[model samples]
Target: MALKTFVKISNISNLSDARYCAGMMVDVLGFNIDPNSSTHVAEDDFKEITEWVAGVKFAGEFHDSSIEQIKEAIKKYPVDYIEIADLDLVEKVGLLGKPLIFRLSITNEEDLSKIKSTLSYLDELTKLVLFHCDNENLFDQIDAQIGFYNGNLKLMKGYGITADVSLGNFPGLALEATEEDRPGFKDYGQIMDVLELIEED
Candidate 1:
């Protein structure tokens, strides 16, 4: 099966989540590579899970790791893309030559300027910006600016994405992989529901 639009399943830790997302033809499967993250995927585990999947790009998600730390991790865990939350790290991280996905956190109106400024810093190496919000109200506020982003950068909504979301000008939606019930078993849950809702023949 194939989704009607671009989809990225993030924080994938196990083979179950990896294989399932790949089978569903998602565009990207992201793993938490930040060692400090509670759900961090070690090199060994990352390899084992990734080995069983195909046809999907892998992303190394970093939250607070420094440039040196990220460089070291890249050598150990090779991923097609790098996902980061800090805007300041963009230029430095881009120098490493890996495509970047900026995870922008929007909480209030004050952040509008920050988002606008982020657009200017995004270079060709920047793949896309994943906008994550704390609440639906904030999502609505930020969603208004989606039209203002008409550059080469792809923008995705990481909040308030339901089966019926208008999708409008955005290229795709970002979803998270659910924890498996057991090593090889999974409930699929909401990710499956949304994927099915948008499934194309």
Candidate 2:
């Protein structure tokens, strides 16, 4: 199944999610690689899961790991993209020579301004910026500013996405993969509904 637009599934920890999203034809699958993160995927598990999937790029998700830590992590499991939540670490991570994805959570006007200003200065190496707003209204507010954004990176609305979404100026959307309740059983929830709606005809 092919999706109508670019899609990224983040925090994927299981082979079930990895293979499922890959079959859905999502563009990127993100795995939390920070050792300090509770959901961090170990090298062995990461290899095991990734080995079963094909036709998608992998993102080494780093929330607060230092450059040295990120560098070390990728050496063990190569990733096509580096995903980070901190804006300040973009430059340092970019030096790693991998396409970068910046994830941000905007709760207020101050947060929006800070991200907008910082994003305008980002270089081409920054491939995508995923924004998760506090509410649907804030998501609309960010969507309105897309035309004003002069940066080369693609912008994805990471929040307020529904099954009947109108993508408008943004390239696509981002969603988290749900954890399996039991080893073999899984409940996909709203993600399944949304993906079915956006499935390419």
Candidate 3:
């Protein structure tokens, strides 16, 4: 079987790892900017990354974000895709005419219903990255729901996707890790182990 690749961004500390893992097919990067905070990357960093990295696709992530904030981030950085967790914000930005990567946190059947309705408005999006919380069976249920879409949008899994999970079976699985708890954050050997697991079926 072929290997599945992904990128996860938690804090700015993971940027180095992301840069090292660049050139992979499915790359996930994040940018979180608070209106009054000066912690996250600045505009120059985004421009530098865009010029340095090539051939790798990025999914920009945001949390507790608003439409205006997201739009400003996208305008300054401009990645291959964008990840939004808020449904209402997604609906507001879906009308912007730019393709995005919507990240939905799956919890129950009702969330699926909401996704079905949201898809009707944001069908032009590049893909949907579903973040499953603690429930493995959720993937099976989502796979069935995805079938109803007739392959109109791609499905990528995230959140709680660890080395123990069978991700090889899911072609578009994206691994998400936090800077503090990430297995390979401090050790190269552990990172390779996680990568090996992802490549295995």
Candidate 4:
């Protein structure tokens, strides 16, 4: 299936990776600004990289941070959007006037209700959602529930997406990425090879 790819780059700690991803034409770029996260990228570093990259959508990832904290980050290194993992914090930060990416963790069938509620709440707050789980089969089953909702909101599906989601599928395929780490892993790569592959594809 054709999908819109989102590359979550955590702690984009350097310019090399940023430039590569930008030039790669990735659909979405997620930056983990959560200070508590081990891969968290400092605002200054984030600003420096973002300044060089264009024609890409950016997301500020947060986990249970207060509005003020997000505001502080925005003041320094603003994003075109924000991604929140804690479902409960949805309403608190949704009104920031930027779009929201509500990341949800569903372990099994029992978590369906919470997922539904979150989706319902996002009706006017967002257009995208990220579903994650330890089991790939479970994630497929849970993702299937998207059809049950009667809204125009879009669900993000990554390689599992490109130079046809091999890179996008890495973390989820490895099952090592927690909700906190969804901004993506920072294992860097050679940019020219990726550009060539995309050209070939």
Candidate 5:
């Protein structure tokens, strides 16, 4: 069982990219639903492309959508996961029963405490959390210093992750990279322990 990674297709301007990524065995597909996002995908176009997206799971990557906005998107996309960077909206949306992919940023010791508390709830509410920031080893550092472990919270590396780096306990990586230089895909298995794909290579 290898680790699984997701490709964040911020903009699906090239429809073929989705098909190519899916064919490459990318585990999850992410689409930006925020209307103001530079890479925002139109709802109709998103729905169309999704029809061609087979096998792998897809998520509606929301920036700061309200509960109503999410409810609307779910009708059209009905994705498997809800990917969000807004910590304030977690419980509000998570309570709907859909698994979450939370993007959290922590810069110092104090933030780490908040992270511990957040993960405590996330361990029970969501599928995974992406540790984002300039700190490369933030995830491991926190665990070593605080010995914080939430039995149910799965961890992944975010921020500046690339394919070549070796991930420790963090089995997954979230990436915005596209083009040929992207990390190659990983075939489906049990969600993966320490290996996840970047959707495309």
Candidate 6:
């Protein structure tokens, strides 16, 4: 019933701040590797940050990039998990024994169908982050999808989750908090509160 918290640190300088805030509770720490993104931290920066924040699980966030690049990053940086937005890249790379979490752009049944088609291939997928891109009523469809996975897959809801709403939800779900989502609070007290609630439940 423990809720795992993942914080995305865009700036490598803020790595210490993130580690300090996260303390000993955070389950995963994410670093953005996309060059065009504002959160983009270089591979060396990722290495330095990971060394500083030892013990806490690490993840690298990637967008539309080549499989070779992704594989290189995984080999060089080597985080516990890799967060990818592209399913094709995931299939091509084959996850390489490392756990993967797909940040999917879910909208309608078609998108879900595509995800379903790839599920059998995503053997390393530990979780799926259902991204709400077009203000769609995704919450309504989640229950059915959860049933479809039948407790085998972990579900993470992204793209509009606030600390308050995140805390309201309980156990067995993953929550990803980006820098843009909550800029001020480095410490994830709100997320920890949610985890505590899940444990209690």
- Clash tally for model 1: 0
Stretches off by above 4 angstroms in model 6 are: 1-13, 36-38, 113-115, 118-136, 159-201
lDDT, candidate 6, 50-167, per-residue tens: 7766556776777766777777767777777777877667656544767776666777777766655555555445554434435556654644554566345455555444445542
Candidates in order have lDDT scores of: 0.84, 0.85, 0.56, 0.61, 0.64, 0.56
- Candidate 5, residues 1-201: lDDT per residue as tens digits? 222443333333335667765666666777787655766777787778788778778777888678788878777777788888887788888877678888777787777768667877777668778777777556567545334463666676565444354455555655442432333443323122223333223
Best by TM-score: 1
Model 5 poorest 10 in a row by lDDT: 186-195
| Cand. 4 TM to true fold | 0.71
RMSD in order of candidates: 1.4, 1.6, 4.6, 6.3, 6.1, 4.7
- Please, what are the lDDT tens digits per residue for candidate 3 over residues 19-120? 554533335555544333445556675566556655555555666667787777777766656666666676576666665666667777777667666666
Candidates 3 and 4, the one with greater TM-score: 4
Model 3 global lDDT (CA atoms, 0 to 1): 0.56
The TM-scores of all predictions, comma-separated, are: 0.94, 0.93, 0.66, 0.71, 0.73, 0.67
- For residues 1-201, write the lDDT of model 4, one tens digit per residue: 112233444334566666666676655677788866777887777887788988777788887677788878777767888888776677777777788887776766787657667777777777777666665656555545665666766665431322333432222211111232233344444333334454424
What is the lDDT ranking, best to worst? Answer: 2, 1, 5, 4, 3, 6
Write candidate 1's Cα lDDT for 115-148 as tens digits.
7677767745586888888677776657677877
Model 2 pairs in collision = none
Candidate 5 wrongly placed segments (more than 4 Å): 1-13, 36-38, 135-150, 178-201
Count backbone overlaps in model 6. Answer: 0
TM-score sort, best first: 1, 2, 5, 4, 6, 3
